[model samples]
Target chain A: MILTVTLNPTLDKFYWVDHLPLSLERAEEEILIRARKSTASAGGKGINVSIFLACMGVETVAMGFLAGHTGQIILRDLLEKGVTANFVWIEGENRTNVTIIEKGREYHPVKIHEEGPRIPSHAQEIFLRKYRRMLKRAEYVVLAGAIPPGVPDTVYRELTQEAKEAGVKVVLHAGRRPLWEAVKVGPYFVKPDVREELMVGDMPVRTEGEIIAAGKRAVEYGCQACLISHHVTGDVLITPEGIWEYEAKVPLTKFKNLVGADDALVGGVLYRLARGDKLTEAVRFGMAAAVASAEVEPKMCLAPAAIEHEMRAVEVQFKEGL
Target chain B: MKARDLMRRDLTSVEPDTLIYEVVYLMEQSGLSTLPVVDEEGKLVGIITEHDLIHAALPEYFDMLHSISFLPNLNQIQKRLKEMAFRPVSEYMKEVTSVHLDDEDLHIADLLIRKRLKQIPVVDGEGHLVGVIRRIDILSRLIR
Candidate 1:
């Protein structure tokens, strides 16, 4: 079974409105804006990947620090969808992240994310204990998402060390301090979260050459493979074997929502890898899943047939000696 | 606190065409008194409740009778349940009133008291079910 760790989980709520007014005419006036549609789901990077894996008939466990009623909802949603939840309960309530989408500009969404609950030392200890036990049954362990407050930045590095010692492949998906620290541990795979910034470590990813350089730097730091997002429709993969660029031919207008596409890519790749597929084929299939997910309104498309149909649109180019 | 803060955001709902047996299984597993029935777009259409189950199990003529002692056997009720087990929830579920997520706790309490409801579904501006608020939730928050 694959193991996924999401330290901070949230109830992701989305509202689609016809028009989002930037300013109010009067401060005292109560302006009531009705949404055209809305949806709520359990979300966290690892949680999303676990859900995607479960949808593809993969055995996976999602571990994290959950709390209060929102945490209960997150667990229920994961279980109902067939992802095993082994969350350590914390003191405060889990956060609720909101996303506001306008009518025409569905591509650009306004996101308001909460800081989430702090992980008390007791909770952190409990999580580490549970994670250690879970590693025995895991073939691949994915440490994804942001570290909650009160937890040390070395959390991912520690997790990577433990998973590697257990002979489990560790996939580190994060950004900022956690990514910088965990890369030094030489995880099996690395996917930096560039939503906040384009730089991976100190290397800027503003150009294609810079993106490849950053990916190469991660691989040189002892990572077997590193994948970085080149753009919305493409990604760069650097490995000891070679470097490959995977791009979807589909137009940007086809995308309805881009929210969980990255998780789908990772989940799809892990699903294929767990099935003993080659890394090249796995990454290709994962890209197709990402594109398929972006074409739908839901966070990630779970249908196997849809992903298979999308595979025809992905183009893979090989580059050796990068 | 407001409805958004107090309401349970984890929605365990079934589609309108979902079979009765599956709904019962979900309700039994989740310990929910009612499950909201949504359409393809997740718009709340109706709700199936324990009361609805009892209403569906009894025969139309049984409403006029005082006791079940007069019945020959309990097979009649069992047969009724078996018949509707594979049927859709839309046939037996009832339309329900819902509160907005931004609605005040006081307003929700007033509605709960006036309508004698055990729980109320919370919706967004588009009438999509976002959460559920139970009376016990309100009382527990008061104590906390």
Candidate 2:
């Protein structure tokens, strides 16, 4: 079974409007914006991946720190989707992230995120205990998403070390400090969440040359493969053997929603890996899944047939050296 | 606490064509006391509960019996179970009593108490199953 850890989970709520007001300067009085439609679901990088994996008939267990009413909703969603839930309940409510999507501009949704509740130290200890026991059952453990307040930055680093010690492959899918700290432990796979910025430990990945350079730096630290997002429709994969770039044939206009596409990609790759597929093949399938998810209205496309259909549209260009 | 806030949006349901045995298996696996039955279009049609399954397994004269000595052997229940296992969920599904998304908490609680319901399905204007409000879900708020 694959184990996914989402340190900070949220009840993601989306609102669809005809047009989002760019400025309130024209308003003379109070403004009341009406949404055409709305939807809510559980979210967090690891949680999203587990949800995707479960939809594809993969046996996955989602672990995380949950709290209050929103956490209850998140847990219920996981169970409903057939993903086993093992969460550490803490005080305070889980965050509710809101995204406002415009009619024709679904790809560029306005996001409003909340800082999750502070996890108590005792709760962290309990999580470690549960995580240790869960490691026995997990072939791969995904340490993804941001760390909640009151938790140390080295938490993912420690988790990676523990999973490595247990001989379980670790997939470090995080960014900034957490990614930097955990990558030092030599995770099996690294997927940086660079939505906020294109930098990895002071190394800017703005240009193709910079991305390859930063990816190579991660490989030097012993990551089997490091994936970095490029141009919204493509990704750069750096492995010890070589570098490969995957670009989806679909245009930017085809993207309906990109919220959980990255997570779908990660889950798809892990699902194939669990089925004994080679790393490159798994990554190829994962990229297709991401494209499929991005092209759909839902946060993540759960249909295997649709994903397979998108696989043919992915152009894999391999660069043998550098 | 309104029905919209109290109801759990994340839940599992079964299709009407699903076998009784499969429903029971799902209930056992999910540890759910009650399961909603929805049509192909996701419309809330009926519901099945553990109580309903238990009642289905009992002999027709069970309610009339005054003594345990008249009870049948385990073989009788096994036989009944075997026969009912293949039956479709539509055959055993009960008429679902549900609440609208805009309903008040007091109204939902009253319905649950008056009808002795373990859980109440939450539906949209078109009778689509959107969420579920359970007795435990309401009680859980007290501790929180």
User: Candidate 2 regions off by >4 Å?
Assistant: B1-144
Give me the runs in candidate 1 sitting further than 4 Å from their true place: A25-31, B1-144
For model 2, how does the per-residue alpha-carbon lDDT over A171-231 read when each residue is reduced to its tens digit? Answer: 9899999898998878999999999988987899998889899899889988999999987
TM-scores, each model vs. reference: 0.69, 0.70
Q: How many steric clashes between backbone atoms does each model show?
A: 0, 0
Distance from true position, residue A274, model 2, in Å?
Answer: 1.0
TM-score of 2: 0.70
Candidate 1 docking quality: incorrect, acceptable, medium or high: incorrect
**lDDT, candidate 1, A131-217, per-residue tens:** 876687689999999888999999999999999998999998899888879998899988889999998988888777898898888
